[model samples]
Target: MTSHAQSQAIAPKGISRFIPILSIGVLFFIFGFITWLNGALIPFLQMVCELSEMQALFIAFCFYIAYVVMALPMAKILEKTGYQKGMSVGLGIIAIGCVLFVPAALTALFPVFLLAQFVVGSGLTILQTASNPFIVRLGNEESAAARIAFMGLLNKAAGVLAPIVFTTLVLSGLPEVNQELLNTLPEMERAALINDMSVSLIQPYVGMAVALGLLALVFMRLPLPVIEDNTVASVDTLSPASQNTQIWQYPHLVLGAISLFFYVGVEVIAGDTIGLYGSSIGVENATTLTSFTMVAMVLGYALGLLTIPRFVSQQAALLGSAVTGFIVTLGIVFADDSSLLISEILWGWTGIQQLPDTVTLIALLGFANAMVWPAIWPLALKDLGKYTAQGSALLIMGIAGGAILPVVYGGLSGLTGGQLAYMVMLPCYCFIGYYALWGCRKYTW
Candidate 1:
């Protein structure tokens, strides 16, 4: 296609085109807030439930595994309801999950908490299936990464806020709760302290449920514009045999899904496990550590906004991000764990707290991961056309990596300790680099 013709075809006529972007932007913001809260919840529940690191990671597993279990079903629902109503239904489901937190908190039951996480993850599965392609299809194909990056900015910004909000709202006035401290306490006293902390969760979750419910109502009434699938290949041009082909016939899409699996696994490990690692290493305010990763992601998103499609193509960005992620994962494993030198050099001059070199490197993974999703979505969904929903669901299913890998990391950490266990992320980035270089370009089986 000529640049001029592509511009006309890609660009929607007026300000009205931006309305769906604005609406979906709200959903992305919500997605980040709910997703990153797992970081804080991991440490908090570990202490409250008196569980080991491996058990605590089940928090992430239950939550993200829901994406795998629900993605295809949610995609089917979207076909019936279309994107707009599907999004509203997703929001309502998330609200229901938030309500579950109330009962989970009052009972101080870890299983209940896991169930709630699964419910929330299922809701997010629906939103992600609908919205990712929505953003990509909203603009010129070449600049799709830039549009997704803009949504990412909002998403990461909420991620930055989620940990701080959880700390302030949920952990305020709680005694210094750690394994060592709890171990020293009498059994009854430890139980009392945990019960108190568990009750604090009730108010915040109730508020979130109410807020999400209202958003669901707004999305229901909102007249979100339906985007036409202009890129679908016409049946008149396809041979009868070609018309019967399955989604798996596209090698690029299959490879893209596998790439996303590894990408999401490493991403979740970097964002959610940092808190657990920090706490294990004796950071006083470890629950808020996720904000550090989120801040790095926001910065990365800003850089992507400035450079993507204008200064660089999406594939180049994806390759660079994968390379960076691999390097950072090595640093996390081999860097001096006791030294705060890295943090001091990077941002300590601002009077903020300094992290050990290892923690700092893990936070840097957020910067490395920020562009991967934005870049991969455009590249993977490039020519799937009418198969977009099925392809998207396949991609969404890859999010199970987040569910599985952190548990793997938890197990590895148990065996080798936290620092060396990050080696698990190395090959994940390697595969993403492969996809950026070759897999995304392959269309045949």
Candidate 2:
């Protein structure tokens, strides 16, 4: 066993250990709320900013791209600030970013909003760099997946709340306002009306800014535990990529990065695009459909907490998630006609409501995704010991797939129709499943 693993295994047992985990859980909830807000923001920007399908996905791109840009810098920052101060700095930066929404909303500039997302994502990069590996260091290696699952539950519950809350505050009028926004009109008049229609944006983000600022202050004052290790920090022009020439030396780490990259892509697609997908399919209250996905994810996280390391192994959990993801994506492809017979039978008998085929399958992707993140992190960082922080940085950088792949989906949807564009998720899940079965092990590359 690695020294890090052994230390945690024989680590002192007390309420103090749980305190740091609980504190990190709070940070996780904060970022999850922030991250999933992109789901609400994407379509909101479409109408508010008068963006094309591809342009709006820049909302996601900017947010996730910060992880790639800032991961290594954040790692070096953590080396200086330590865990508690690093988290405080992250929260503070996010608060500043949230405050930027005031000017963005006031001017109604899409680029400024994108900038805000970028800044907030940068903050989250630092928080994640510190917290993820720290969570592993907190307890026994075997139970790491369970700890992450518990954190996932907190994370996803905020996800469920975010779209609902954002929709309530920002998008009040259901479809009528959307129809007005989409309808033909004089360009000057349409811009004025859109500006008026989206006047609620400032207040919500101001509230978020204030909340985040207070949390940052609270984190600074809290007595969090310390872990010891030293790294050479290069704030010079030297890039982390160039400095770590030997990063690719770890085959499992590289493969894990690939698996996480594709995993994040589909997870974002399922969470962020579902509302838009529902809208295209003519579902009433399309934005509300996002809650269905989040609810499914919450259930998956809770199940993982109960069963992992006891009823099911971490690798087994990952395999189950990936297989389920593949089945659901296939179900989405054949959703309409395939469900017709079952719909008819169910309606003919008890008269219960039938789900829209696409949204139903999209929602199920949430359950498939929930376990993937919790399982992948532990497996990827399993035995890295001193390299654990850098490994975490690599995996976090892979999260940029969330940015790149969804924009591809959005642009493709515009060309080929939204329903057909969902084919992208299949290959993503296939990679995750491959990792689950084989690629997670050492020398499997």
Candidate 3:
């Protein structure tokens, strides 16, 4: 080939390899933005729709449950078509889901909103199934954790911004609208006024639709590297034949998956429920309360971007994070209300400030949860070879813990008030701690 032609071909091939990573990062961002918005949405929808505490939390349940429902199917689709095509199809699904928001909002139907979230989550499951494994295979097996950590930074960065943007656009104005209606309008007019609040969601979701469409188009044009799995199974590691094997077959991976499941559930409970939690603790302006969690998460991602790979191994990071998570959970549970000791401790040591003790502790969990995914994934899928796709699907399904655990917490809150209910996070962290200490060390099939 001519030198220039060779250069062109080589460049596209190199770019193609990175495209799946990039596209997956974008998909992660979309998921983060959509998923984290629930932090704001639960409270916002609660007021607009006049839902009870438990009822409003169904917002999170409906959205994350799609992972459980769609993960296996997403794996099946990816098996039929490679990751690249599956990613494009996933983005298309998300676009359709985003468009669903328009009609859902117009009708002022809360269930329709939940249904739309389900569709969006379903799309994300497919994208995650395809993208995560692709990113892992992009380089040396040893460095998979580091690469996934980099992706985690991107994912969490989107998560950090999502609540801020959504709250500013859809929720910040709500209190004023509610006040004005209450002061001047009659009872009947209040319903119309509350119904009009749904209109705020229309523009935001329309923007999401446009962005998703453009991304889908870009993914279609990008040339991604085709990875073929060819590793043969031995008694040494997990294989498809291991299906008949005990959950202990891949002890480290299964433990890692369990840790991930619990970590995600706790993280979501922290961010997604903090606004309402703040309200229960007498903090008004739920929209602004989310800034605490968002900022803390941003700081953690910053630390990961700066220190991971070069400065620390993923295992060390995971260990340190689990320790911090346990400490913070304890603080939240046991710290007295009279003293702001936890807040002072976090601010003085970590330089994160201007947050309530409860809120600050929840944000600290973000740091603890930051490296868990990166540390866990490579360990879980280690040496899986040809079964990597199916293994990844199983890991992805663990995300349903995010869906299940929060509902449990929400139900507890309904039964015992939000403050006491936060104790649910303690056992979740305990499971994560167990995984970090010894769960990632399985040396046999």
Q: Each prediction's TM-score against the native? A: 0.95, 0.89, 0.87
User: In candidate 3, which residue pairs get closer than 3 Å at backbone N, Cα or C atoms, i.e. clash?
Assistant: none
The most accurate candidate by TM-score is 1
What is the C-alpha lDDT profile of model 2 across 68-99, one tens digit per residue? 99999998888778877998899989989998
Which residue pairs in model 1 clash with each other?
Answer: none
User: Which of the two candidates, 1 or 2, achieves a greater TM-score against the reference?
Assistant: 1
Rank order (by TM-score, best first): 1, 2, 3
RMSD of each: 2.4, 5.2, 5.0
Error of 3 at 255 (Å): 2.7
Candidate models: Cα lDDT each? 0.88, 0.80, 0.74
Which parts of model 2 have CA positions greater than 4 angstroms off? 1-15, 172-176, 179-189, 229-245, 337-354, 443-445
CA deviation > 4 Å runs, candidate 1? 1-15, 234-244
Give the per-residue lDDT of model 3 (tens digit) for 76-101.
Answer: 99999788888888888888899999
Clash number for each model? 0, 0, 0
Candidate 2 global TM-score: 0.89
lDDT score for residue 168 of model 3 = 77
- Stretches of candidate 3 off by over 4 Å are 1-20, 171-186, 233-249, 336-353, 443-445
lDDT of 2: 0.80
